[model samples]
Structures are given as structure tokens and as C-alpha cells.
Target: MACFHPLTMMLTLVLAARLAAAVPFKNESYPLTTVPGERPWNPIEPLQQRLAYINATAMAVSWNTYTSLPDEEAVVYFGTDAWELDRTAPSRQSTFETSRTFSHHAILSGLEPGTEYHYRVAHTNCFGCSTIPTYSFTTALPAGDCTPYAVAIVADMGLMGPDGLTNSTGKGAGGALLDNETNTIQSMVQSLDAYEHIVHIGDLAYADYFLKASTQGFYGADNVLTNATSIVENYERLNEAWYDQITPLTSQRPYMVAVGNHESNCNNGGVKDKVNNISYTAQICMPGQTNFTAYAEHWNMPGRPGPSQNFWYSYDVGMVHYVVLSFETDLGEGLYGPDEVGGTGKQMSGPRGKTGEQIEWLRQDLAKVDRKKTPWVLAFGHRPWYVGIADAVCEPCRLAFEGILYENNVDLVLTGHDHVYSRSVPMFNHTADPAGYDNPRAPTYITNGLGGHYDGLDVLDSPLPANVAHGIDGVYGWSRLTFANATHMRHEFVAARNSSVLDEFWLVRAREEGTCVDGEEGHTGKDNGKGHGKGGKKDKRDVLARLDE
Candidate 1:
């Protein structure tokens, strides 16, 4: 064994600590310096994705482009019929970082509700390019409409590869696929007909993994600018691939999303500059981060519109009011501190930053939900308040926000961060409601972050809590919330590979009170009588075949 002098050992430890603090991804060695005049390139033509229904009367359309056409505006042409285009809405262009790419967003307003409209997006500068096919989407019906509808909910979905699976993890382009559960995201897209819209809870592309690993050599070789450049280039490539994978679905259906830890832009310093908010706003047009980037410039979400940013807004779809919140931001919890697991932690209120807004906003937002109009209230955010995973439990977030949901009579709280699926019995303040999911006073929490990613599924920690109704791991899947009517909602978790439903439950909203009906364990997608089972049972499940038909 070799021994070192005390002073030498002290110096080494200090140097190691400095390196760890300098960059967010300690395992990767990214350049602290800039590579001038080196921008990533993409040849794909501009196509619209990330279609969001800002309201019944407005739809926000956004897309990306690598090649720029100067002095031209983005536009969308549309009408009730595909060929007879009767409307044109012009868009404003924006970019997050100079090295990234440009994104254009435009809102088509004054559309009739419950009607399908055909539309196509075109760039003003791409006159020489051929036109793309027309797409169509149905505007959401008004509250109390009692229209039966379904929505696909997922989060943490990464990129795909030549095999139509998540790209393998590697150093550069076409890295090795880390998780075999790649097909779930694509499967969701393929089965888009089963879903009226998609609520992506967060962590869309997982490009940060590439950025982090590439910035530091995968093998810790101390590679600098070269790796950093590759990081940006790889992000660009992954975005393009992800765009293609999702365009088929997003173009024709409203794809709503929330900000996750991955999309926090902590790498570039939290919505500080154009590079941070550009990509985020270009697609989702969310709230919470208004200034410091193009978020305010590109998206036009619903609710107190002046500058809410979509951070905390509620929109009605059928008989349910879907509330979107930004748990990624400092949501009044003491989660933000100097020693973040990665990157500089989210900033409190500062120059060009926002904070201490969610609880108050939520307080008012819930205060206005009229149960008579929108009988069912569902809330979604990036992080989960409760999970069986040890390191993944966010009790502080629960302490800060769960009370608001419980008080507001929120029926369901949907979240995705643990990369697994877990359903909690109707709960309040860490205690299961005595009613046992039947007319419970609290909300039912479901964590369905398993939209497939390089990180793979999270493992179950010891001593599972009693409130947990169902928990599954090592499966790639998405949840479908089918609003059968104002009084009934069916929640199903369908496996992506075999299309087997792993778990399910029903929420029965009676005129007097709401009752939660738990399905059998490993129930296998069959009628199990009112979707309620007292004892666990194992049975063969049927395949959904295909959602399109």
C-alpha cells in the first residue's frame, strides 16, 4: 500500500471537492469554456408538434427548425375541411440558446368547441420546400358537457432509435439503449386513438443525461470542449428524433405537459437566459417561468392570461377540471438549498426569477372550482408527494402542498418522478382515510412516472406502507383515465410490450360523495365485478389488441 503526506492528502481532497462543485454532472467532464462558431445542425423540415388546447376557443401550435429563414413569420392554415383552408394564424419565432435551434409558436383562436378542425403549419422562410400533410384535432367540450373521454398520462419518456425503441445508451450519436422498456412511449403514440389527449407529467427527452455524460467523458477521461459540443449536438439530434417519434400523435391530438426536474434547465442556470426557457416554452407553453427567456414570447396558455406562464392553471375537459402545477419550481417547501444533488438548486425570487407563488396560486385556483360545472377535479405535477421508494419520498412537498389538494376536494393527484407506478389509497396527512377509498375525505395519489427512460424502473424499498394499494416495477407502461361519465372514471395501467393492464381502479362520483373502487391485484383487464376486490387474486389478463380500431 502507498501512503501520502498529510498535506498532500488534504490538497487532493480539496481539489476533488472543487471539481464536484463546479459542474452539475460530477461524473461527466464538460467544458467550462465555450466553443465559438460551432452550432449543431439538423436537416429535418419544420413540422408542428406539441399541440396544446389553451382553451376551448384556442389551440397553441409549436415546432422547431435548425435552418433559419430570416425576416419570415411562422403561420398555420386551417378550416373545418382539409382542402378548403379558411384561416391563417401567424406565429412569432423564438430560440432558447444561440447554438440550439429556433422554435415557432402560434395560437389559433376563435374555434368552435367539440368540433374537429384540419390544420397545417408552414414556415415563412421555407417557401422552396414542399408542403406537409394536413392534420386534424378536436377542440375540448365545455365543462358539464358529460362527454365520455380518455387521456393518456405519462412522464420521463426518453428518445427512440432505429429499432423504434429507446436509443441505446452510449457516448455520442445512437448510444446504447439503457432500458428495454423503450416501446412504451411509441406504443402510447401508436395507441393514440384510445386517448383524447396526452398529459405528459414531465421529463420528456432525457437529453440532460446525454449532456451530463458527454460533458464529462463517459469513462472519466477528462475530455472538455469536444465532449461539451457533443453534448449539445447529441441533445439536438435526440430532440429531432423525439420530435419525429411524437409528431404522429401530437400533431393530431392535444399534448399537454408539465415541467420536471429534467426540464428545469438547471444546467444553464434556471430560465436565466434564452437557452433555458426557449425549448420548454416552445413545446408546452407552461407557466411559472415567464421572463428571462422566450417562454412569455412563444406560448399562450389559458387562465389569467397576461403572464401566468401556465405554471398553475386549470382547464376543463369534459366534466373534469385538469389543474397543472409546477412542483419543479420552489413550491413553498424548503426543498431548494445550496447543496443540490445536481446543478445549482432552483433559485428563490431574484432578478428575472419567480418564487413563493404556487401555494397562493393554488389556494385561489382551487377556491374557484365549481363542482357543479366540473364535477371531477384532477391535479398533475412533476414530482410525487408520496412514494414507497426510500430516496424518492418527498414528504416535505406533501407537507407543503397536499393539504391544499385535500382541502380543495381534489379527486386525484397524478404525478411522475419515481419511474415506477404506485397507487395510494385515498390519503390525508400521511394517514389513509378511514373510509378506505370509499367516499374518503382525502385524495387518491397515483405515481405513474414509468413512461420509459434510460434510468430504468426504480426498485421497491422495504416495508411498503399500508396506504399503497398497488405498486409495480420492471414494467414500462402509461395510465389511461377514461371519464366514462360525470359519475365514473376508470384508471388503467397498460403494459407497453404485451398491452396487458397491470392495475386498475374506478372512481365513482355520486351526487352525495365520491367512492373509490379498487380493482383486483394482477386482475388482467377483465370484468371483476364493480372493479372492487377484497382479497388478492391472480388471473390471466386480455390484450387490448390495438387502440386505433
Candidate 2:
């Protein structure tokens, strides 16, 4: 037996405690200024300003205001130049049952494709007008235009410190650390010009885990729900903080999003009736806690004729046709259906039934794609069929939409649910394509869920599936998709801490009128046939150099 000194033991214990200490949830809100005025009544300045692509000639700008303004006052003023604002579009204000603030959205239309426009949101009543600082965003390029562009892909990203560092040490119930977000956000900001827009597939803020703490346990520990007001306020504040954190990027670029499990429900553990064990009730949940109340209220995605436009929609940017799907509900067959998982206990039955609506819509959407115009077709959603963790694999989702996607010859599938970065060979039905990425028969899958979140990071299981070409864990990062030309596209997984390229791959396919171009000849895919290893040496150097400049 070995005896340890008292001082040594005490020091070791203190260090262990520090490592395991849960960082308290910060309730800091965006430092928004009130409208400039000496009048007794002044509306709160707009916060969480964001942009979404409505069409080639239109874009939707949304923001949050704590004080209610008259309907006539909500509007957006815009023009080609920041000083000469000439056009105005009325905005609609909306709020949820438990919301403390109102959300306003205004659509700016009749704009030229690929043209930059400066805009400001404000209350423009007859008395006076108060406006936020002007921001600019360039409209999307015309459809069918094979212009070279890149889009930053992120998922499961959460709030970071003001200086772009990890703010929380508490690993939530899922065991994911709330670190690496600073790296991810800083990298994106540094290379803002590198991508046209950002596609955040799912798990935006993780506000659902508002009660996560070391003492209370990560998940919704039943005891913490006693104070309903506190729960609601914290949840809302966390969301506000997260949006404020991303405003630097989102305000400047179009931030597209999809629903993830975190967005599905608030404190998902519901209380079940012990007698029958057949029904459950959300005792402490607010109106925004159940279903996707917060998500739908926050974002005004492109219009689609259905219960909600945010659930499913399609848009085109440059040479890529992008489709956003819903894994939480409306999938033909899955754990998440109407009133199943995060639902409000109300069925979404209408022209399109609950179960098969999204799937049917997807089939129609994919069938309408014209290969010649937009040569690359990419679909993004929250849950993933293939991931590093075996138990996290969404078999139901795979079964629901795999056949249609494979049949349509989709080019790429992007998802983020398992909290890791992974890329697969272009294959189908659990088999790797022998031809590799060069004109493969099936769509390649990239699971980019490693965007920083409260859960530290998922542990990868040994003996990865056969189809996975590369998979990485314990790194906070995002993926970048560069559509170089009609027949060539490149995917790179970038480490958030240093903007280093952890993995690189190019999808090569011959279009009807063009052959695949060897963009980076030697660095076609992962190095030495292994995943997450450093590759694309010259390209990585160029990216770092650009960041320095």
C-alpha cells in the first residue's frame, strides 16, 4: 500500500473538482440601445437581426423587439447605398403565447439578382423614425447560373463568450461539452467572404437545456421545473444570448436552419400516467417549450403551402439546388411524427396527412430537379442515418427517405444530429461504392454535427460502419461546400480552433455538357485512405494565408 501526503491529496481533489464544476448558465442579454428620443415612450432597439433567402429577387429580414410597436411603425427601409435609403417594406409582428418579446419580419422584393442592398429595421411612424444600424446582404445569384460559390455548413452550434471562447464548462445530459464554439464562430467570421451564406442544419441554440447544471444534472432534472417563471425566463434569455452571439455572422449573411432534437421539445422528459402508462403531459413546459413554437416563430423560411413553411422547403443558390427537410415530424415513418416526440399533442392533419406529408413533398421536390441547370443537388436535415455512435443511428429516418433520395440520384446529403464530423463514400444500402467519389452511383453523406454545443462531444464507437470514409470526434468544427463548377464540388471539414483542414474531398461527376475538372489533383480525398487526417496541404495553406490577410 502507498501512502499519499495530505497536501498532495488536497491539491488533487481541488483540481478534480474544478474540472467537474458546472459553469452556471449566463443570463446575459444583447446590450441593445433604446430608440433615440427624450419622449417617455420609446421602443426597445431591434436585436437578433437575421436574413433568410426568400428568392432570387427577395430576402426576408427578421428581428426581435421587447416593446410592442404599432403595426404601422414596423417596417424596413432599404436602398443600394447606405445613405440614400429610398424604399420601405412593412413588417408583420408576431409572438408566441409565452413570449416576452415580439418578432418582426419584412420581405424586401423587386431587387436585382446578385446585387448588394443596404437595409435598416425601424419604427417609422408619422411622429418620427428610429432605425437600427444599416446592414447589407447580396441577393442570391440567378437560378441555373453555374457561378462558383461556397456555403458554410454548421449544426449543433451554441453560445460562446464575448471574446469568442467557451463560456460553459457544464457538459449537458448528452455528455457534450459547450466548448469549441468560440473557434467555430471565430473561424467563420475570419473567413466570412469565403462562403456566400451559412446552412445551420439543426440544433441552433440548445435553449431547451436551460436547466442543465452540475448539481441538478444535465437533463431536465424534475426538481428544477418547480419554478415555471424562472424556467421560461432562462430559456428565453439563453436563446436571446445565442442569437446575439451569432448576429455578427447571421446579420451579414443568410443563415438557413433546420429543426433538430434540441429544437423538438423543452425538457423533453414528460410525466406519464402511472396507472395506464399510455399518456404523458408536460407539466412545467411553457407554450414555446413544446413542439417547435420557438423555431417557427423565430424564422420565416421560404413559403410552402403546408402547416408550416419552416418544416420543408427548397431553394437554389448558384449551381446547387438546396432542399431542407424535417426529421422531427412528417417523415413517412419515424419515432418523431405527429404528437409523437416533440409534438404539441395535436395532429397535423390536412391536405397532407401527418406521417407521409414531408416524404411525399420531398419526392416531388427531388423529381422536379433539372440536372443541366443546377448540376449539384444537396439535401440537409437534422437527424442522420450514418454516424460515429451506433446507438444514435436513426434507422427510421434512413428507411423513410433513403429510397427516394437514392432513386433521384441526389448528389450530396448533409446532416447534423450525432455531434461529430463524418463523411461517407458515395454508396447505397450500407455498401461502399467501389468507384469512390469519381462519378459514384449514389449520393455522398456528410454528418457535420460537431458544431459546438452543450454536450461536450460524442464518443465514437469502435469498428465504424463500412460506408464511412472519414469520421472525427472531440473537435469543434464545421463543413464548407464549394461548388467550383458544373461538374466539380469540394467539401472540407475545418477545425474551429485554428481553421485547419481536418479532412478534404471532392465529388467529381460529368455533367451533360461538361466534364469533371481536377481542381486539386493530388488532394482529391482523405490522405492515405484514412479519415480526419490532414490533407489538401496547399489549399489549407491558402485558406490560412487568406485569414491572415
- On lDDT, the candidate that comes out on top is 2
lDDT of 2 by residue, 102-198 (tens): 8898899997766677787766542222323567787876666655667899998875542112543443234333443345766787777777799
Per-residue CA lDDT of candidate 1, range 431-462, in tens? 88887556667888999887876545676665
**What TM-score quantifies how close candidate 1 is to the native fold?**
0.74
lDDT of 1 at 535: 14
Off by over 4 Å in 1: 1-44, 68-72, 124-128, 162-182, 211-228, 266-300, 303-308, 333-353, 512-549
The window of 10 residues in a row where model 1 has the poorest summed lDDT is: 534-543
Each model's Cα RMSD = 15.6, 12.5
lDDT of each: 0.59, 0.68
